[model samples]
Target chain A: MSHEELDQLRAKLDDKNMELLKLLNERGNLVKKIGEVKSKAGTKRFDPVRERKMLDLIAEENEGPFETTTLQHLFKQVFKASLELMGEDEQKTLLV
Target chain B: MSHEELDQLRAKLDDKNMELLKLLNERGNLVKKIGEVKSKAGTKRFDPVRERKMLDLIAEENEGPFETTTLQHLFKQVFKASLELMGEDEQKTLLV
Candidate 1:
């Protein structure tokens, strides 16, 4: 690819990154809301059953150069991060 | 909140998860394209300057219950996953 072509590709990648960031934050917001409900209901913070279902759904939707295993692992990290954010928000609420 | 209210929140979270999944796969596709360009041009796979700039940009855009530090850490994981996918794709090409 020419230099211009390469730069354009990088720009596209940057746009994708920003989109992912926004989506992740949206997910984080939902996680916080769920955390509040969980706290109120005395439910566990981590739900393995739901996590497994999520992984299954992601694998079904994956049409990728990325392997299913890789997608699973990446999404597990995303899930973990969201959970951490939820915990942090919960702590903050407790402190207030 | 009532059980119905909690269930509604969980359903919303499930929708967010699907949206994030689609965005992540889109990112993975872009990463593959960028990886191809990097391989052809003999450029480094990892770019720390770009990574740092990305972090800074994300922090600036962040209006969050999640802290800047949390966003940075989460994004780092996403970046790492993208790099891993790139590397995997490169290796597959080499093997072919």
Candidate 2:
């Protein structure tokens, strides 16, 4: 097995990681925007129905070496963090 | 405020999640391939130096509503999972 093959594969993995990074940050920005809208509308940030729907969609679309449940758990962690961020926004609004 | 705005943003968020799903599975596949090569070459699967470099790159690139530290933590969780997956491949080879 050529070291070159391993090196090339690592490069590709790095590229994928960067793509993931961009998407995650983009998603974060969207969540913040949504937070602003929700704050204005006086609507609560956590919508269980929508969260469940998103998780279901992920489970349906997953074709993976990682199990659907594992991915869901990881995604939920990010989603929960996003919720906290929204809460932060709410707190800031209250302060201001 | 039209509910339509919230719904549209939700749709975009879902799209971003799907993209993340695809990239993660793609990364998993690459890691598995790298595991095979490493197994054949008698090299260890986890390379801390490479891992550190990748994390550093991510920290550098993070421009976020999500802090760089938060992104790094989230990424490390996924990376650890990938490492476990590589271990699974190694085990299957030994079993075979």
lDDT of 1 at B64: 74
State the lDDT of candidate 2 residue by residue for B59-80, as single tens digits: 9988887878788888888888
- Report how far residue B91 has shifted in candidate 2, in Å: 2.7
TM-score of each: 0.88, 0.93
Residue pairs whose backbone atoms clash in candidate 2? none
Candidate 1 accuracy as lDDT: 0.81
- Local distance difference test values of all predictions, in order: 0.81, 0.88
Question: What is each candidate's DockQ, to 2 decimals?
Answer: 0.63, 0.78
Once fitted onto the true fold, the runs of candidate 1 whose alpha carbons sit more than 4 angstroms away are none
| Regions of model 2 farther than 4 Å from truth | none
Q: Name the lDDT value of residue B31 in candidate 1.
A: 82
> What's the iRMSD of model 2?
1.0
Looking at model 1, residue B87 earns an lDDT score of 85
